[model samples]
Target: MDAAVAEAHVAALQGEDAHAAEPFRMSAVKFAMWLFLASEVMFFAGLLGSYLVLRFSHANQFSEEALALNWPLATLNTVVLIGSSLTMALAVSAAQAGQAPRTARFLGFTFVLGVVFLVVKAIEYSTKIHHGIVPSMSLFYASYFTMTGCHALHLIGGLVPVTVVGLRALRGRVDGGKVELVGLYWHFVDLVWIFLFPLLYLI
Candidate 1:
């Protein structure tokens, strides 16, 4: 989308501001969310860098360790995350259209999918633990635990804001920009897993 158009969209969502020098630019909330997402990009980049280095240096061990991962379960979780992203997008679209009920329902579906992804991840983790595969087991296992565990933690952390947004949507208080902001974060989380899935499981 054109930058000006995107700016206008955000401005519309935030409502016209009387005190601003330039009107219909971008909302403060959306600006801050983009900055926050930039930081998150750097954080995940560092983790992925470290993981790639370890994997390259210990290729044989990493390959062997990767075999223990439950590919079927991880694939299912990936599908769940993808579905959540779809619902999140719908929620944003609904909110933009001022359809509060539809927005709330879509947000609820997204939340449920997020929970299901985490539950599937938990099952995978338990199986690994049962097989004595843990961070202390080896360097490969350590990287696996660190990367996947961090992503899972993020998913857990995301539940709070998603729940709040969903509740606000139900109560008819959510604005378009707010839903878009939350959707951006939710999509980023899902995108990270898209990169992670093949790296940790399929590779």
Candidate 2:
């Protein structure tokens, strides 16, 4: 059979129809993306729950403590994150369209943005510490550490995959929906920060 016909037939398969043909077997990659995203949902839920607990239980302390946070720095990081998300989306689009070089370029830009975010976060963390707002000092500081630290780690985690994808794009190796998948994950990381900024930093 022609490749197009075979691909069309396989693409049309659903549920048990997939088992009818070898080429129509359900995809491990697709399954993994869903499973990974489910786990990510749980992870973010836990973080948000922690934030809520700390916010309401010690509302006055948290609010008072939050007064010292640098809004200018947080706002700058927010713009950086949103920009990275845009680059990520473009990389995904380029990859889907088989423009490997463009995909690599955009992915590289996204990775650089991630690095810049981490740097800014490090600066923020340093400044906070210098001001003696250590986690041991207040419930708010502890929650801030736990929540923002986890998010920083997540941003770091996002860095690795974006770099990997960019490298693969350079080598002309990655394809399919891999770019889109990374784009989704990276966008989610950015989205999480978006919610976190106003809630934790501005509020």
Candidate 3:
């Protein structure tokens, strides 16, 4: 064959193979995740907005009700959550590097930290309830519980996928893209808590 025809043939074969690749590629998955996160952003935005409106509307009562929260426990949970985010990032890095064992270990650590955060939050909730600071007691209490409760639910939901990913990593079945998607979600959860911690506990 002539040199020009030979080059064209090779290029055509490469194009065909590329076109025949998997339909559900990593880019598709990442795009879907971005869309999902966008919706979650709006949902959380509404919740935070409601909480802020309530807080500012009843500033005096809100301050008094905020005094009922266990700042020490909340602060501790914040630290645990931030630590978990770090571990989650490391897990993604390991997955990308194709180190399945390391990925699994980091993911397991992240899961444990998530559990610790929930435990501390549960303790704080019980303490507040014991002090008669239930949601119905005041607007601040209501906003606080609703915001944190939704967050806790998200954390619980996130744990399931994290556990599954970690198990898959142990079996050397997880791909880097899946790990990246999960990491995005985990980071979002941690970021929400970062905002909530100071908003509810400190400020």
Top lDDT prediction, candidate number: 1
Two-way TM-score contest, 1 vs 2, winner: 1
- The Cα local distance difference test for each model comes to 0.90, 0.86, 0.88
Q: How accurate is candidate 3 locally (lDDT)?
A: 0.88
Highest-scoring model, TM-score? 1
RMSD of each: 7.4, 6.6, 6.6
- The superposed Cα distance between candidate 2 and the true structure at residue 1, in angstroms, equals 36
What shift in Å separates residue 73 of candidate 1 from its native position after superposition? 0.8
> Candidates sorted by lDDT, descending order?
1, 3, 2
The TM-score measured for candidate 2 stands at: 0.83
**Residue runs of model 2 more than 4 Å from their true location after superposition:** 1-26
lDDT of 2 by residue, 79-167 (tens): 99999999998898899899999999999999999999999999999988888878898778887888899899989988888988899
What is the per-residue lDDT of model 1 for residues 1-36, given as tens digits with 9 covering 90 to 100? 699998986786677653463654688888888899
Worst lDDT window (10 residues) for model 2?
Answer: 17-26
Q: What TM-score would every model get versus the actual structure? A: 0.86, 0.83, 0.85
The count of backbone overlaps in candidate 3 is 0
Off by over 4 Å in 3: 1-26
Candidate 3 least-lDDT 10 residues: 17-26
